[model samples]
Target: MEQGQAPNGLSSCYRHPGVETGVRCTRCERPICPDCMVGASVGFQCPECVRNGSGTGHGPDAARPRNIAGGAIAGGDRQLVTKVLIGINLLVFLGGLFFSGLVDELVLIGLAFDPELFRVVGVADGEWYRLLTAVFLHQEVWHVGFNMIGLWVLGGPLEAALGRVRYLALYLLSGLAGSALTYAIVAPNQPSLGASGAVFGLMGATFVLFRRLRYDLRPVLGLIVLNVLITVVFREVIAWEAHLGGLVAGAVIAYGMVSGPRGKRPLLQWGACALVLAATVVMVVMRTTALV
Candidate 1:
């Protein structure tokens, strides 16, 4: 042994005693060679820690799945999209309070789902945006507040699972389905505007996403049952038709996204979601044609 070096068995790399590197695993605190070191948030980890999933061997983003080619976390955070959605809904509702004619022009006459509009004005009337705009409208303070709460509760996890683009697609498609159904079933002139349809869609999306991850479905199932009960008990007030439409649309879209093969998951999942949105557009066209 060299004069300055410790004895071979006393304090040397576990994998390479001849080498002088004195690094150790953050988790196990055992001597490790650079070859065995895995980058962790605070310090280096060992292969054993990586294999055991005991350490996030990259950083806080390590736990999130990353795109292999791009190195970006697949879903990132849920804060920005959900907050923006809530902000828009609140701003519109607030504007309606201060401006006497704003609600009539933007929501009731403009955005609320009304089959009669299609019948009287025709699809070329530029009122087609109502399919989505109505999802952001609310009749009362509690209405928007309650719906925003649902969005915050359910949007975070779903967005984290599906990523921003897909999450937004699911929400809009589900809302479209809800409004389409309402237009199909409700009286032609009846005005209906609320985020209940989109909110119900979030619930359905959450249910399907959890099921894909093989999570405990009991809590999700319970929430679904409770909401269904509320819709039934308060059918007159709830627009149960819209809720059912959004729920079915969300579940079907989620199933399509989750059931794809591992290799083609992203491509197939997004394609399936796009098809759902396209189908909703067709429904609107057909319904408007028939009504007109």
Candidate 2:
């Protein structure tokens, strides 16, 4: 059989062409179907992710030192979109404050969503725009500040890698996914807004990009787990479900976009993302609405 061809059973592995290879890479150890094997620096690597040098050394951004507390804030290089995003979030938050006296609470409420938005008729009756615009809204100054920091830390490197459009798509997709998850699972009645959903997606994208570049993820994995733990246990007012959903979706989409040797077509990848979003909407309607 040719190297790329699949085997019935008694055939050479996918990693090596004619050596009758059976071993696979340690991390994503798919059976090397006679075309995918490589010698590892330490144990052995999948031809897909063979990195030079020993595995012990400075990580991607080790040149900069982070204070113990500061490290939790964000990671990786900064960029223009991340900065502008932070500025916009801050400005809107401040504007909301000044208008609080003059404006009725419903004005702000109009910008957010309640359980009733997904009416029993499978429609977004009133607060439907929250599906998109809520990403830019925040109830508190500190909420905006924290989410902006998250966006800056996570968004810069991703936007640089993906250019502008792909990054923005991932951000919007992530936020929608988070909101959908909340509606479907946690609390449909809850009015949630913040960039944390998009922000968590950045971490997800970062992990995907780093892992693809063959960077070791011991430190990154530890911090991600710790943050998830903190969000769930120690924190209140944080939509942990939204963050969790966005993180998972972001990582998956990022990997599909920029990870591996071959890049997925942008439109195809986005179509799949839209499909997932639609599915989430269906689920939320099922959860929050009843048949007439």
Considering every candidate listed, which one attains the maximal lDDT?
1
Query: Local distance difference test, per candidate?
Result: 0.68, 0.59
What tens digits encode model 2's per-residue C-alpha lDDT throughout 97-180?
A: 776531122221212333343322112344455555667777676777778877876787677656555677788888778776
Query: What tens-digit string does per-residue lDDT give for candidate 1 at 103-148?
Result: 5444422223434333333122457766677788886988998899
Q: How well does candidate 2 match the true structure in TM-score terms?
A: 0.62
Score candidate 1 by lDDT.
Answer: 0.68
**Ten contiguous residues minimizing lDDT sum, candidate 1:** 66-75
- The superposed Cα distance between candidate 2 and the true structure at residue 115, in angstroms, equals 16
